[model samples]
Target: MREEHVQDELGRLLAPGRVDATAALELLIRQALAMGASDLTIEPRADRFEATVRRDGVIVPLAEGPRDALPNVVNRVKVLAGLLTYRHDLPQEGRIPADSFGADLDFRAAIYPTSYGDRVAIRIFNPSHKDYELPDLGLDDETRDRLSAAVSRPEGVVLLTGPAGSGKTTTIYALLRHMLRMDAERRARRNIITIEDPVETLLNGVTHTTINEAAGLDFARALRSLLRQDPNVLVVGEIRDHETARAAMAAGLSGHLVISTIHAGSACGVFSRLLEMGIEPYQITGAVTAVLAQRLPRRLCAACGGRGCDSCRSTGFDGRLLLAEFASMSSDLAEGIRAHMRLQDLQAIALRQGMVPLARQGQRAVEASLTTEQEVRRVLADA
Candidate 1:
């Protein structure tokens, strides 16, 4: 059946339009905006398109699409989102808004281009006006206080490391907000530059650049220019290449506080990942200050929340909190890196110097009852 022909005649208590593939697709997203669902998934199979909302770590099936109409539902979403012109063997992104909610969703979409049929996943980005507050990140007081001091430094690289959707970006935004509050008068007079792939958020009072390695407007060049601009603070979305890492060190050495994220499993892994990316151990030692690695787990629902239930959505989870591993640079760890020792060796030294691994952070959350042991094990296992 077509979306226009979808009947809202389902039982009142069963959730309206939930079984109608067409209307449910729209209704589910709209409901996500209404209920503040953080993520949405559309699973297209050989037999049907399974559309579900990820609320409080649970998969709530909103609608089931007929196999024959699977393409239509997927294509409609892409077309409506401005993601793609038509179905093809390529990946794309599309984002459209529902006027009723006045919410803008940023979709990081992909089409597998598989023989099983094109599979699409949509990760929503909800930019809240209040998203930049530090206290609002749901971090524990201990975690918050430690991170707060790291940001207080005058010159050094404060790295934020985590996997995608792990709230690393949120932590960055929150920290920036915290800085703006702490030294608004002083910060107002300083130059702050950022090099992000596709600038996620728009921060006031900062010079932001989008990275384009193909055009030579990459992080290395941007950092060099940002230094010339005499920035007091710097934010780089990702540091994967040697050039960017070198530039980051140069800036930090020249009295700028550099901030960036690396794709590492633990806070300690940040060092190894950097070395793997080709940064010399000495350069890595010279520029680092603190590494704050975190992951976002679902938060519990105060209402309709339970240990386990049909409505709990079968994931045995509710909402999310942060599992963080925070490690600050010390003289001993710096000496290990300077001596060209292995990252594993440096990590052991870091632990000896009071660095907390991210896995420990997750375990603390589990012990606090903020999340389940399974949730902790799922994320911390990588550490």
Candidate 2:
């Protein structure tokens, strides 16, 4: 749809005192997705309400509606998320599934009290997409082969590390699917379970549990409980603290294949993070199979042809491509780690053993025009 048409539709739907505010909000979400937005933010100011959508790593304002209509829109979202509309002092979070856009979408909704009114933000996740395959993530042939081999291990920890929004969870989901597809008999016998904060993506043949700190259900507590369930493959959404890291590492040692994500700059940096988390060196050496780090570089939009266009918001970039680096642990590397070798020395050995560094992978993406040098510099510099 044209931008003007979208604007007009929004204006009509958001007309003051409109009882169809829920329908208008749903239309707004569809329009945001059509504009290639990954996140939608609605802010209520003193005079009016402003809405913005995140596209290509940048936030662009979409529309502004009357302050009177803001409550109806926010309440509609609150009702959908099962949050209390009457309460305004405390923040609340909830989620609901919407298929109004002709796709299965899981929308996470949160509301926060403000000086003017309440603010609402919604994150959209599409669960029916099949683009989470290994080959689909922008991994080179050698790195892909090594990663596949790493996950094939019957019992070890495969950690995907990167900053936020770097596609770590998506990659982990892809790895899980890859493991299930490689063998039918194993899939039939093995039980796969995941403990995630929000359970972003849904997968068949896997049991997913969400984190509930309010009810005393957390990652560490759940890991200890799930250990008795005989889960062949365990997935921890993230290793954030000492307790969770210890539990995840212990699970790997006890003969379960553990897949998890951590926040780190490179594959080589994962060990330092684990050590900083107060985990023993030997525990990491024995159970770690591989560390894969990834980033999402904005791909040039086909509709723009690398030039400014309405479809791409004149940024020349639309979607993102995966740029990844991985280091698979070898016996020699593990031995050196056990011996308390210097991180640089261990990283050198990993590089010699076909491990690709993030810089190298990102450079390859730049050379292939999958992304630009400026973008690479920005991401690596941040790392």
What's the C-alpha lDDT at position 319 in model 1?
57
- Report the C-alpha lDDT of model 2 over 1-383, residue by residue, as the tens digit: 66567667778887765647877787778878887676788999998888888765567878887788888989888888889989989999988656644667778888999999999888877664434788887787888898898878779899998777777877888887887787675645568899998988777778988889889988999998999998988999999889999999999998999999988777878887888888898899988888988877788778876686977777888788777878887888877776777778878888899777778877887787777888787667645
Compared with the true structure, the alpha-carbon lDDT of candidate 2 equals 0.82
Candidate 1's residue-wise lDDT over 12-38, tens digit each?
112423334345456656655554566
Worst 10 residues of 2 by lDDT: 123-132
Evaluated at residue 311, the lDDT of candidate 2 is: 73
Which pairs clash inside model 1?
56-318, 81-95, 83-93, 83-94, 297-320, 298-319, 298-320, 299-319, 299-320
| TM-score for each candidate, following the candidate numbering | 0.81, 0.90
Off-target runs (Cα >4 Å) in candidate 1 are: 1-24, 56-62, 94-109, 129-132, 138-143, 185-188, 212-228, 299-306, 309-316, 342-344
